[model samples]
Target chain A: MAVSNPFVLSTPSLLYALDLAGTFVFALSGGMAAVKHRLDLFGVLVLSFAAANTGGITRDLLIGAVPPGAVSDWHYLGVSVLAGLLTFRFPSRIREDWSPVLLFDAAGLALFAVTGAGKALAHGLNPVMATLLGMLTGIGGGMARDVLLSRVPAVLRADLYAVAALAGAAVVVGASALQLPAVPSALAGAGLCFGLRVLAMKHGWQLPVAAPADPPPGKD
Target chain B: MAVSNPFVLSTPSLLYALDLAGTFVFALSGGMAAVKHRLDLFGVLVLSFAAANTGGITRDLLIGAVPPGAVSDWHYLGVSVLAGLLTFRFPSRIREDWSPVLLFDAAGLALFAVTGAGKALAHGLNPVMATLLGMLTGIGGGMARDVLLSRVPAVLRADLYAVAALAGAAVVVGASALQLPAVPSALAGAGLCFGLRVLAMKHGWQLPVAAPADPPPGKD
Candidate 1:
């Protein structure tokens, strides 16, 4: 049986480009996080790779893609390493403004969510699970990065992080179920996710926090 | 093709018993962590499930066991949930002393390391990867639990945690390579891991901390 090499040189296309772009931004974020924590060079690279590849690696693992895509492909590894090095060398450049980071993160989230859902569907998972897995793929890397840094995961607290991913994943799954064209469905899904995230950030939209023990604000 | 049900009612043998026992103890520890963090009931249960099943789930995913052993097996889920509820209700009882929790965690680590290595070898992984996976299985649950709580993972810093797991896994993988009897090999591996962990605790053994930018101790 011939093995499929998804990241081979011959597969130069938009989707692959999007995937690498997402990975680069995520790696930059991870490296920035390491800088925030004052981690050494080794730790910076470790965090960068973890942040860049964890989502895809996790999605692949769950879907039974052995030797996970991130581990198997040298290009993915090269991209992550380069991103880490660049972030380390120009920490101030990346950290000067939080807006760029948020924008990049949103883009990565949208792209990864769509691809994650698409892969899950292709792997024979039920639609609901595929959608959830897609959201997981979008959020998993950030979660892992935060946890390793001993910080609360942004997805569990931030405005519209997972919501955007889920919305994007839903569009992909829904479109696939309805037999829509692949490229258009993917673009639509990614666009919705990105737009919603940017809007949420601009408007300060947030999911309600759990306050199981606290009395109603004024009633107490 | 016939799918194997490893956790069926009829399969209530030693391995099954060990797995359940490990899950229960890990769940208890997770619940304890949640209580310490003052998380709500829902959070406690979520932590419990993550702590109990993450090791096996991670191992299964890496080896291409789709749906994962944790997700597919009802017994494991039930045990983890029950343990969580019990821990939440009796938090005071479990918190009065730390000795029992440590002991239980050590036992779970030992058992999981052996089982993880065995499973990886069974799935035809190379010996080195199999051993590493075994260590990952032993420590993965605790790492997940700590990370979710926004704390540094104990395995990364605690006395001989990952070391003991790796040692146990090496024994299992080595013995298997040499065609040792399964039962005796497993027993030996688990015994070594548990004994090493207990000794490390008693002797206050720890991995050295990094102080990259600091001057030499004498200069300081």
Candidate 2:
């Protein structure tokens, strides 16, 4: 987005909101995974941390963001811990259905993608690298989550996960280049990505690739 | 290490040793984690995928490796499946020993660091970046391991986990530049790292960062 405001990224409260909400949702997803895996109370939080915050932490480390996400602020810790505890306290009672799980996960994914891309842009990464880093931040936690749970990655099988986050980041860069307002452009970019993902899920949409039976894969 | 034998990089025997050893050690660690978590048959293999090979897969993906690690090699799949089966059959038995687990994990860390740095060097990554990536590839699997186990990271906590890997990679690169024999230098690098790590563990050597005391009742 345009830099006219000069403080959009620097807003402390906004960062806190993103971190808290993101951590909460991520932690919840992690805890839920533990339920699926039939793990113990300790297992729930371990899965939560793996699922929720690793992406941003990985991104921060890669981009040379000193102290990284978990270390820079305690709010992320607070949210992750709370979500994990709640999930531990009431796994089945809290989330009676899978839809809420997916929705909250999607929201966290979208939020992290946009926020990650924002950080990448702030650091002046190449556009291609920026888009990739954003996608990585979005799905990295889930990948970690799935791996820990022994599930195939959600992105690999049949989801528009990475592309959604990539598109969101792409539009933000595109809009910022054209001098759009920071908040509106970010919202628009994030909204576009989120809307596409929701619609994809609603309609069971997915990317087309060669059949798995065929051994050969597509170009990188 | 010298360009005098560029063909050695793709030599069948060398590559085979690298692949088999890497897969074996990673699988051992993965299986161990599965036992710790008490996952079912499927869960054991699933965690193995995450713990054993995901680090190499991620490393490949980030470095623009085509087909990634999981898809490009059937050997990877074979190793994962075999490890999973082995884990399921002997979880109770395997869970008995600590020294064996650490030995396998340590060996895996050293091997992957060497190979990961070699790949990075092939891709012409700078020494600093290659060293960092080598460490990441070495520790990434373990980090995934610890996260799934729900503990503060072993590497992050103290000792020479990632640092040893970094040192190994650095030595490999330096040895290459000096026209040292690749096999001996590689072994030396690996030995230096693994030996130092063992020493660190035996001697209780680690850097300590002080934590803040809890605030009084009026504060957080």
Candidate 3:
């Protein structure tokens, strides 16, 4: 079982590095959100970890990979904590502009999407399920962060957020079907996802909302 | 591995029945919430499944149970759908009184807590972790439902909600430590949890909130 565990990634240090970078950036977003919400320092740290690791943890769990890498590896925790501490210490600096956070989030989403699909495929999921899993990985972290803050998940309402992830995941699956190399396929997928997200943000692209006859009541 | 799978529960027909019952009640709560939120039919069904199964799915994932029972078993889906449809069709009848929903929620929480701890123990988790997992299982569903509705999780602020679950889980772990039979131990755990929750609701018991000098900003 140990020999077959794809999460080990002993030879793919680059991919591991990208994963850590994604964790750090997502942690930054989570920490910033916590600060904005006036949560205490401990709460900020918890949000950071939840945002950084939830997607990977969920993917691993679904694929029968016990003790998710985010849990077993100290590096993920270290990166998330570092990002959280930075956000807590310099909230004004980080919160001054939303552009950086948005960019970082897009990058994290792209990385997670491709990586999630590859892992699912490695675990023998069909192409369709692998694609769906990839999108789930991309969106899972933000969804968890939003949920903790008691907000409707942005992915459900944001401009082409989930659609972009699905598109990116589809690219990876398509590449695999064509027998393309993993590195190139991943790069292409990430590029497309990042591009779509940034463009959607810039252009204010949005999915259609259900319009009811009367406005819904304010109370839950 | 098949023989070692603790979730099989070949002889525990009663537990399975109880689990499905818990699922049905929770789904009813979720569907009612969706109707209140003015979500459409699809939204109601989605909330039903999410509210009913999120706890068990999360517990299974953490314990390395791949393809969570909620995903693999048709009965769980069938029960959730039935509850959702019932609520959608008869919102006025089900939502007439809050008391019934609250009681059903407590029952679901109690059932989930003891069963979650029992499963964790069967999977060889330490007593402390198993107890924590039980509490997570009890609260996870409601938290997810509230999050989807863009409201603060009732469990986080509700009267003794998480505390009651933890107490029940602790009782189950204690019984296991004493080598008590599974059936009676589960019954005792559920009884204690249900009692504590109802008492808290009746008496308006609450955990202290952080008293910041300034109120937090309204928007996230």
Candidate 4:
């Protein structure tokens, strides 16, 4: 089998790359967040794993992939723990330098969106569902991470996060419909997502916040 | 063939009752928490649904049940939304009524623990895994609810919450091991769980907190 197509460099390898890269960056972000919250060492590791894998775990479950990959794959577990340990050891490396953190986070968000959509397609979901699942994969981790720290999910409150993921997912699903090679198509989607996220951060782009309404029942 | 077991006194009926009752109580708690947080209407409803069904959805996913029952079944959706809307409409009905909230919360916890274990057993998980899944089901909703509301999860900090659920699950699993009727075993387990939770609340029995530890890396 002379594999000339870049996509044929092994589908599993591409997926594995996406998963590990995303997991590492998200774990770092989660660990840093934990440090900011003054969590103990145990709390930091818990948050790291939760933030790194919650999205993939969620998507896999929704697609009927039992014993989610995170649970079954020792590699995912190892990467998450390593991220936590590194963050604990090198807290000063991340101090108020938000740009580097933002950049890596965007990379993770983009990669996960692409891989998530691809996985959903492989699992036989419709384009629309796959796209939505992809976006969920991108945003779910951060949501879990923030919630664990007792904060409103950043996805709901932050700038262009889910929207960017959606765009990336759409690209992946669209390319699949055109019969494009998987690796290149996924790379393009990831690039677009990462670019948009970075631009959004730089320009402070945000979805409009809902105006506060009157209190619901139980209050005067 | 005629069904002779007490467990068959309408299995679906018993399951439906447990599901609805648990959903209603948890939804109420979620709504009230939203009110406490002064979230707008959408926020309240979202929180209510998350509190009412996250646990079941989680368990179903882990067991390879795709499009979880909560997502596929409109009845569950309707009940959750109705609870949210009602809480919004009649907030006064809940004010100054801490005891009722506590009682209902305990009920939901107990029922969910039993049902969750039952589902896990049906899925062929080992007893230990089934028991853990049961505890996860009991606590998952409230943990999500508290996290969304930006509060520390009561399960981790509150009195005997997860422990009570575990005990209940153990009873149910034990009964199953002895080939007891499902209805009676479940009822016994739920009753024990509810009683233990109530006692814990009345006596302020809590899991011991971790001693305060020094900050992890990057601290002066």
Best by DockQ: 3
* Deviation (Å) of B121 in candidate 2: 0.7
Model 2 chain B worst lDDT window (10 residues): B211-220
| Candidate 4 per-residue C-alpha lDDT over B90-201 given as tens digits, one digit per residue, 9 for 90 to 100 | 7665665768888988999999898888777777778899889988888999988877766668688678899999999888778777778888888999999999999999
- In Å, residue A63's CA in model 4 sits off its true spot by 4.0
Please give the distance, in angstroms, between residue B34's alpha carbon in candidate 4 and its true position after superposition.
4.6
- Candidate 3's C-alpha runs over 4 A off are A1-11, B1-49, B62-64, B70-143, B150-220
Task: For model 4, state the Cα shift of residue A109 in Å.
Answer: 1.3
Q: What's the lDDT for residue B46 in model 1?
A: 61
Ranking by TM-score: 3, 1, 4, 2
Q: Write the per-residue lDDT of candidate 1 for residues A1-220, one digit (tens) a residue.
A: 1222222122236667778888888888888888878899989999989998898898877777777778888787888889889878888976579788888889989988988887777666667767877887888899889877867676655677888998999998898778777778888999999999999999998764332342322200
lDDT of 4 at A20: 94
* Candidate 2 chain A, poorest ten consecutive residues by summed lDDT: A1-10
**Candidate 4 chain A: 10-residue stretch with minimal lDDT:** A1-10
Winner of 1 and 2 under lDDT: 1
Score candidate 1 by DockQ.
Answer: 0.15
DockQ, every prediction: 0.15, 0.04, 0.21, 0.17
lDDT of 2 by residue, B160-193 (tens): 5666787887887777667666777678777877
lDDT of 3 at B72: 50
Query: Measured with DockQ on alpha carbons, how good is candidate 4?
Result: 0.17
Our model 4 lands, by Cα RMSD against the true structure, at 7.8
lDDT leaderboard ranking: 3, 4, 1, 2
